[model samples]
Target: MKTNTYDLIIVGGGILGTFHAYHALKKGLSVLQLEKDNFPVGSTVRNFGQVVPSGMAGEWFDYGVRGLEIYQSIQQEMDISIRNNGSIYIASDTDEIQVIHELSAHYQTKGYDHALWSKAQILAKYPAMHADYVQEAIVFDQELSVEPETMIRQLHIFMQAKFEKYTLKYDTTVIACEDGNEQASLTTSNLEVFEGAKIIICNGYEFKILYRSLFDDSGLEISKLQMMRTKPLPQIQLPGNILTGLTIRRYESFEEYCPSFGTIPVPEHYHELRKYGIHILFKQATDGSIIVGDSHEYAAGNRLDDLGFAVDTYINDLMIAEANRIIPMRNDWITSSWSGFYAQHKDHMLEVDVSPRIHVRTGIGGKGMTASAGYAEQSIEKLF
Candidate 1:
């Protein structure tokens, strides 16, 4: 390799790309990371920051387990705002309660620790929770949370300070890529070229840049999600990740593990929830404000703009109303809201090598935050 060459060059600065760079650097491989923006503002920053392996299944769950270890390991080395607050799933009705109970048993069989909490215990811990809304609860105390807005930035800083083999470049868009017998090369918007022994493109959902036709035919779809946060309530306390009944019904782990799942009847009134793919979730930020979200709406990869950039007040109102049913959050107190987007393949993640040395690993969808750390480590090993 030449002076400007590296052992690995990672495209995209979100969690997927950064984690790949982290592992490459850990292996003593010289790494170069490029981000189109000054900083990451995609799903990595927009998510609820809940890292619950209990919400994942199979290999993804295994990846999330390792992700938790990776996150805690990073936090211990430096302050990256990692919290072991755990996650609690509040069951709002008998069907939901049964689903959680069965799911708990499934975990018990797997030797994963879990506790079934009575409504009394739920109320005692979450004082603000609606008494009638929670029929039962299941708690996983091993899960973690992070301050999404700062974790990546701080991780970048940590890498700069700790790893002499790492280089991070922001506001640099990769415009072209080529794979040669000896090295893989990419050219940025400035037409400057950098070479690497292997190149991995993890640009999240933005797929049209380097290999448009490949991604267009790769069965990728973009999902748009809505999010909101209430005004700071320094006096109130809602610790850990608060996942509600809708979440229990929707999270993949439940669908796969819970025998009662899909057997529960949806009342006519809840049709809209199913129509919009709404799953109410709450996570209190470090600033004492609660983060509320999210509803999913999708469009084909070629029609990313069809998902639209405008925030839907009706969706927010629906979320706020549903959130109020579970917790005492006042809609008028919600100070800020935004939309997040990510690309996903319905059956599996978008991972295939366009060339032997030039690899593509975008479109992991909602699994990115929970499993990216471990998945990227595994991906790096396979690529090299």
Candidate 2:
């Protein structure tokens, strides 16, 4: 392989890296993006494909809205697949219903139209739901979903077309980054070295390995979430994003900015069994198949074992039970399941640090997809 130099070098090919690359190229900076895998085999592709903004903190609400607008405009201006399928956070219990009411009030104050639904209205819209299980709902008509894998693939294509000078090297991993005061040199796994005036590390979970010294005291921890995709049920009609009261409690805005009802304790019987930190978010893909899941388990590395299977099964069972309450249909055909890891810090906001020529962006928490474009733009403004 030949060694080359560029104005900017991005360390990861995931959504964040690609997004930053796209923005950087638009600034007319010669850019190169390196990825260890040929395709995005990370959490970027494994997630629910949900570009959710409804539950984000107030500080990041604008970023979410901006990113949502970017996705909505991608098809018209650029090349990408984004579906504004609209999402709803359904409340089943009285406490959850109260949370929805509070969220509606906060969103209205923020000029967002989060529609508050009465039980009668919800029943009229979704008659499949068990009357007893649904009390109210908050519908975010602007929330959307996309096939993440497809989006990434299309982004690369679009980048190639728009920025003919941009370079993308797949199956090339950055083994080491030497950050000097003026510039950085990136040595790849194949012994290929590239130097850039500026380098942005967007390696997601692999950040600790590349910059362990910088983050030694940052208190960054990796969160592993298990998720599963169910077999397509021809009869099931998932109208929107489905969530319960637990989601409202976990999301800070709903608790602090919105001041929702007090947290409800999980039943003692299900606490240990379910490991239910928050409620499940169920959304259907363009295909009839429904993607259900999600249980948070934090660890140092992306590791899995037989014990995780039990927990995954428990989570799937819980989601099925909740889905049945809303849409009673027992099609227990599970197609496949997998787990992914995301970076989380004490503060949910992403951090961007720039020192002359070197730039760093990370700590997106789980909202990377939701605010990547806006965050990348912010980074660009600060760096340039």
Candidate 3:
């Protein structure tokens, strides 16, 4: 390759793209990463920052396990601020408890370590929890959490400072991609051309811009969510990544559990919450602030404006109320709230070969944070 030519050209600057860059650099491959905006403002930063392999299954679960290892290695090598907070999923109903029982058995077969706690044990361990609804819990001691608000930015800074093979281009949009017999050339918004042996597009949910036909035909849909964060509560200490019964419905790991464990009989009044794909999960940020969310709605397109960025106050309030029901808070004072968007497909992730040398990966849904890095590494190895 020429001096100016890169070994790999990675499109997008989100976790998927950056993790690809990280792995490529690990293999001593020169990389050029492009981002349309000055920084990442998508689902990469607007999430609970919970990296829980316990929430995934099969290969995805393995990906999450590898991702946690990567997070740990990066944090130890530098200061990426990864916290080993672990995760606790509470079962509020009999159906949810059944899922826990089945999942626990499944975990044992898979060599995943976790503790199944009775309500009494849970109360003894965390007396602050509201015991009225929670009957049992599963504690995943290996789960990890990071500060989503700052993790990506700090990782980029670390890469720039620590690696000489990496280059990041902000405010740069890829306008065209042409693959040759042995290499690919990409034209940016500035009309500048760059060449690489392989071109990997990790644009996240912004699919239409680069490859509209492939994106449209890939069966990808948009998922919009509402999330909120509270001001730093110096007096409060959240146990870990707190998950409620609704999570069993949203997360894929509990799918088998659902069929065997049976469906949860949600209250008649709370039917609207279920209709909107709402779930309650909480995590404490490094600043001592609490992060709570979220509800899901599918969109026809991948753009945020078409789906709208407005946070539904009704849904937001319902989520906050549910969180309060689980753990009594000192105050319900929230400092920030917003809507987040990501890509999803009914079956598998939206990954396809746009050309012989050009590849696109997105639509991993909410599992982006948990498994993007590990999956990206695997994908790149297969590609090269």
Candidate 4:
């Protein structure tokens, strides 16, 4: 028989929503996750799938640590296409080295296991990196890298087989939600109604759709990025997640080390790249293909066409040119390029309780993959 009612109703099937389901199942609650499309095709799959807690700050860093634990636990239980590969931040100049030293102090204070590799040590292990450009490197051994395209699908499959009470319905659009003391009613696009004790909305970028009034009133902005993946290159052997000087300014964790960490000036030739918030990060996938990216563009009030959503060749060219300078990769090696959009706010996340029984959570920004598992567990605990 079809389940007419569930213990919890989760909207959206992205990583955030799926993690919420995982936690709810741990609570022994029957879950029904609704996805508008066949599967999640959002920032969750578009990202680099890098879970580097070293790039986050404050509570977010803690959440990242817990998420890392969750990912590792799942890996022990199943074949989730996970990689325990670590991350390395290559400092090219003295200024970048200063940022690394400051960040190292904070990591040590927090008891995060890390090591500062000298130029000689870095070259000895990864000789492919330019010798003159590398001054030092910070090695984070606990970080993880996952296959973005398969992780979610594999997770969903695992949930279906593991939890008999869990149900995932795709191509099901939740049109309206009515909250009450006893139970919450969700009306789908087909006018089919289902009941659940609680409703949680996790539709990431679709903030304005289900709750238009609240989203309009809230100060949520749209952030778009342009990224590319290269064809499999058998010659290159990347040591781990490769981060450059631009990333030092981009991630908040570095700034926690030094408030003025992001104040370094951009070189004149890279003015156009800086205009779009371009950063060069390279990661070798399991298939030996490298994932290269990305430039940030902020759209106010979800402006879809004002450069943020569009994939401009000029901006992509600048990113390719910059990546080439960093690692000397062939421009023609780029096999595919695309754009991704996500909801962002100045705050850590946008969590709103529409009613006593209805809650909406999103605006996780770029830390979705890194912090979702831990954050969702805490959210579910508080909700119950």
lDDT digits (tens) for residues 241-316 of candidate 4? 7888778767889977765586766567667777988988888888989899988888764564564455888888
**Deviation (Å) of 113 in candidate 2:** 1.6
Winning model by lDDT: 1
Residue 105 displacement (Å), model 4 = 0.6
lDDT of 2: 0.73
TM-score (all chains, Cα) for each model:
0.98, 0.90, 0.95, 0.96
**Superposed Cα deviation of residue 76, candidate 1 (Å):** 0.6
User: Candidate 2, which segments miss by more than 4 Å at Cα?
Assistant: 180-182, 263-274, 300-311, 329-331, 349-355
Error of 1 at 34 (Å): 0.4
* Residue ranges of candidate 3 with Cα displaced over 4 Å: 1-3, 257-259, 262-264, 302-305, 329-332
When 2 and 3 are scored with TM-score, the better candidate is 3
Q: Please report, in order, the local distance difference test score of every candidate based on alpha carbons.
A: 0.90, 0.73, 0.84, 0.86
Model 1, poorest ten-residue lDDT window? 267-276
| Candidate 4: regions farther than 4 A off | 1-3, 259-263, 305-309
Q: Which is superior by TM-score, 1 or 4?
A: 1
